[model samples]
Each structure stands twice: as C-alpha cells, then as structure tokens.
Target: MSLKKLETLSTKLLLKNPYWEYKLDNYTLPGGQTGEYHYVHTPGAAMVIPVHDDGTLVLVKQFRYLWKKESMEFACGGVKDGDFLSTAKNELSEEAQLAARDLRQVGEFNPFNGATDEICRVYLATGLSKATRERDASEEFEVLRMSVAEFEDLAGKGTIWDGMTLAGWMLARRSVSALLKEKRL
Candidate 1:
C-alpha cells in the first residue's frame, strides 16, 4: 500500500507564548481517517559553531530547567523575524561572548520534527574575537573552549548531549576539518 500525506482540516491554538505556540491540528489521514495532532509552532532557531584560530570550539555550559541538569552546547538561539544569520551572531555573542569575522552557514535541520515545526540553521563561525555585549539577564552560562579532539571525546562519552549541538556539529564538522586542513580558518 502507498502512503499519502495528511491534509490539515483545521488548526486550533491551544496556547501561545513568546517562544512558541501550542497547536491542535485536525487532519485527515491518507487512510481517510480523521485525527487530532498536537504540536508546537515556532519561528525557528539558529546555532553557531564558533571555532577559534587554534581549531578549538567555543561552547557554553548552562543549566536546562526542563532537564534539571547542566548541558554543554554550541551557541544557539531562536531566530527573530526570520533573520537567521543575525540571530546566529547575536547568540554567539550572547552565549559565548565571542564575535566572528567570518560566519558561513553550514546547514539546517529540524531538531524535533515529530513534535514541533522548528527548523534550526547551523553556522560555522571563524576568525573569532572576544565580544563585549552584555549577557541576557535571564541567561546564565559558562563559556568553555576546548580542542576538537577533546570535544569529540566528551561527545563520544555522552558528556555533551544537546540535540541541537550534536545536529549542528554533524552538519559542520566536515567543513571545519576541511578549513583546518587548508589553513583557511
């Protein structure tokens, strides 16, 4: 049997907040069955992999209230008004206290396709320097710099478990390796 796409009959707003909207969608399945689906709708997000001159990565260790534990991840933030690069740069500065002279978009991914309509654009930021922007008042995180190998080791051992960070790294690691090999970054 061939599968078909779902047809959304209607969407109801269950809740709305500054960050996202909880939605209840009524749809007709390919099998001619009607059902209700709940999901989150968002304006999307951006994540930055900040690589230093020596090929080290700048990450942030922050407490995740939902998870109730500290997590380490690449600088990331939600896109505002559909500006991906600006959000990436702002997030880099805000989360890691660094600015990039060159920022290249590596790739994009949907972190939680089953639950949300949030696509995250990933960027590779090189030519880094310290940024002097004030951190967000509600944000508290520690910036960390580590070699690529060390980062891989930590990731391998499951120390770094942020889905966005892992997804961004998967998209940008090859470009990072190529730049390092060519001494371009």
Candidate 2:
C-alpha cells in the first residue's frame, strides 16, 4: 500500500443551472498519473437531536424519495444561508414544531465517501417546549415523541434507521444523561 499526493485539483462545470449543478475534476495522483472524475455536489446540511427533559426524543416520519419509503428519523434539514445554529433551531421548529432552551453541538458526519460532497452537522437540543411548526410547502412530515427507552428499543429492533441520526443519537444520549444529572443536582 502507498500514500497518494494530490498534485492538483481542477474543477469544471458539467451541468450548470440555478437549481443544481454538477462538476467534473481532474487530479494528479502520487505516481504522476492524472485521474478524471465527475461529481454532483450539494450544500451542507444540519441535523438535530431534540430531547425533552424526561429523556424523550422528537422524531419525524417522512417519505424519503431515495428509499421510496417512510422512515422514522431524527429532525434534519438543509443548511440555508444562515448560521449553523440557526439552521439547527429552524429545523427543530420546522420539522418537529418544538424548541429547546439549551442547544449544543453533537458532531458532524459525511455520508458519502466516493464522489459526492455532503456534510451534515448534528446538534443536541434539550429543554423542549411546544411551538408552531411552519413547514415548507415541499415538506410533508409528521412528528412523534418517544422515550429514550423506546428509541433504544427501536435501535435494537432495527426500526431507527438513518446513520447520521443514529450517530447523533449515540453522542446525545451520553451528553443528555450527564445534562440530566446536572439538572438533578
């Protein structure tokens, strides 16, 4: 096995439009070999772990076009032209119709490894209260509240899918336990 050095990376537009764009690139490898590839990239996004004081989590049930089915997933949405925290908060409200007083960054994840560039920021949201859910016209999702035990059960039972959501839940589970302990004292 050998390590590769990127001598150069040049980007070219394969498909250009206002809605979306596709790009092509050529990179020089370590052995002086140039490789060409095409990529379809999109802006980064954010996901939220909306937890209640009682160790409950807010999940959304929506139709995933890629999977061609509905899945029980955590609150997540695209990062618009705003701060990451604002994106998380907005997603919590829009997707779950809930808000939290205490919000913290859990972690970030990159789902694709081959060509596409997609980064999703995950956040932990607690101290939840009811709020208005102003969903976008394209957004048709339903919110559900479940206990942490239920989530754990779902995870074990193979119900809670979505790798990003699972990763965020794992981190938030530990953090929220400590947070709850601190609140108790």
Candidate 3:
C-alpha cells in the first residue's frame, strides 16, 4: 500500500531563536484524521571529517550542556546564509583550528528527521593546515587527533554519541579508509 502524505493546514511558531525555531504544524491525514505535530525548523547544518596528512582524523571534545558530559564530534555547525561549504569551512576552523586545501562533499543526511527539519551535509576534508581558532563565547573545545580505527572503536563503544558525528562518519568511512590505506603505503 502506498503511504499518504500529511497535508499541512497551518503552522504556528511556538518559539524562535537565533539557531532554530520551534513550530507546531497542524495537518490532516488522507484518511480524514487530523493531528498536530511539533518540530524544530532549522536552516540545516554541515559537518566535516578532517583527515591529516598522516591519515589521523581531527575531532573535538566539547561539553554538551544537554547531555551534561563531554562529547567527541567532527567539526560541524548550522548553515549560515544557506551556504553549506562556507559553514563547513568556518566550523572546521573554529572548532578544530584546521583548514583543508581540498574539501569535497561526501553526503548529506537528516540527523533527526522525526523531530527536526535538519539536513546535515557531510564533507571529507584533506590537505590540512593549521589555523587560528576563534570559538563562540559559549563554546570551548579540546582538539584531538586520532586514527580511524581509534575513532571507530570509541564510536562502537558508545563514547562518540553525537548523531551528526556518527552520520558524518558513516558517510565518509569508505573514503577515509581508502585514504588511510594509501597513506600507510
């Protein structure tokens, strides 16, 4: 059976912030059922998997307020002015203090489609060089460099729990493995 789509009747803004907007959407199902769905409206995001010249991955460890613990993740940020590459570059510099000479789009995914309209574009960044980091006033991170195997182990053990990071890694895992294999030779 083909699934019917929800027809949105109206959308109410519940809250607004500089980052995202919370909205309530009233919709009607094709079967004559109506319901209200609340979700976050976002401009989307971009994440970068930075691989160093020696094939180590660049990541960041930061304290997540909601989780009340430190979380390791790839450099990522919400899209600004609807530009994915610009956001990726800026986030990579700000969060990891590294700039990539070769930045290529890997893939995109909806991190939490059921709860938010956020599509995060994942990029594979290489040809890295150092840059001065300028983090936001509310942000603090410790840059880390680890091998792909190490990252995978941590991710498998539940140490790396950020959905965006996991999605980004999954998107770039094959490319990363190839790069590591090439570098080892």
Candidate 4:
C-alpha cells in the first residue's frame, strides 16, 4: 500500500523558533482517514564530537530545561537555513570554544521521527584549538575533556544518556580511529 497525503486541511503554527517551528496540521491519511498531526518543522541540527590527538574527547555538562536535569552531551546546535557544515563549525566554537583542524561529517539521523522533522548531522572533529566561547544569556554549560576510554566506560554504564551524543559517538569512534591511523598515531 502506498501512503498519500491528499491535502492539508489546515496548518496552524503553534510556536515559532529560529531553528524550528511547532505546528498542528490536519490532513487526509493514506487509508482515507482524516486526522490531525502535530510535529516540529525544523531546519535540522548539527553535532560535533571533538577529539584531541591523544584520544581525549570533549563533552559538555548542560541543564536541559525540558528534562529539568543536567545532561552530558557533545556540543550541538541547530543548522541555519541549509548550511549544515557552517552551523557545525559555529556550534563547535560557540559551545566549546574550540575549532577543528580536521572536520568531516560522520553520520546523520532523525532525532525524533514520529513527532518532529529535525535531523541531526554528526561530525568528527580533530586537531583542535581554543577559541572564544560565546554563550547566549539563557545558555549555561560546562566543558570538560576525558580520555576516549573513559568515555566508552561512562557510556557503557549508562552515564552519558543523551541519545544524540550516543549517535554521534557511534559514528565518530570508527572515524576517529581511522584519523589516528592516518596521522600514524
């Protein structure tokens, strides 16, 4: 069976944001059922796994207000328009005050498929340096570095709980290894 969208009965914008919009839409489903679907319309996002030459990974401690808890995650932010790479670079510097000497896209995934259209593009960044850290007035996060091994242990023990972080990590570990091999490290 092929699903088809006959038409959107109505589209009501619930919330407007720089990176995404929350909207409630009414439409006809594939099986001729008319229903309402509320989802996030977004320009998507970017996540960076910053690693040093010695295999140290950069992580951040930030309070996610929605969850009302501190979470450990890779530096990440939303893409602008359709410029994902530039957004990744800016997020790396803005969130961690570091720039990547070598950066490459490792993976991409939909953060929430059922309710949102936001896709997170993951990148592996190496050969890093310190830059100016700029935080928004509402943003507060602590940056920390740890050995890759320690990160693995923490993640394995369910300590690093952010889904996006794990997704980024899954893509980055293999790439980071290849990067180290190319550097003959």
lDDT of 2 by residue, 70-116 (tens): 88888887665747788888988888998889888978877665766
lDDT of 4 by residue, 61-167 (tens): 99999989998999999877698899889888988889999889999998889999888999988889998866888888799899777888988998888988988
Question: What clash count goes with each model?
Answer: 0, 0, 0, 0
Report the C-alpha displacement of residue 61, candidate 2, in angstroms: 0.7
| lDDT (10s digit) by residue, model 1, range 91-124 | 9999999999999999999999899999999999
Q: Which scores higher on TM-score, 2 or 3? A: 3
TM-score of structure candidate 3: 0.96
Report residue 109 deviation for candidate 2 (angstroms): 1.6
Residues forming the 10-long window of minimal summed lDDT in candidate 1: 176-185
lDDT of 3 by residue, 112-179 (tens): 88999999999999999998867899999999999888999999999999988998998999998888
lDDT of 1 at 108: 95
What stretches of model 3 exceed 4 Å from their correct place? Answer: none
TM-score of 2: 0.87
lDDT of 3 at 90: 96
Candidate 2 Cα outliers beyond 4 Å, as residue runs = 16-20, 183-185
- Model 3 alpha-carbon miss at residue 5, Å: 1.1
Worst 10 residues of 2 by lDDT: 16-25
Listed in order, each prediction's TM-score against the native is 0.96, 0.87, 0.96, 0.88
Q: How are the candidates ranked when ordered by lDDT, highest leading? A: 3, 1, 4, 2
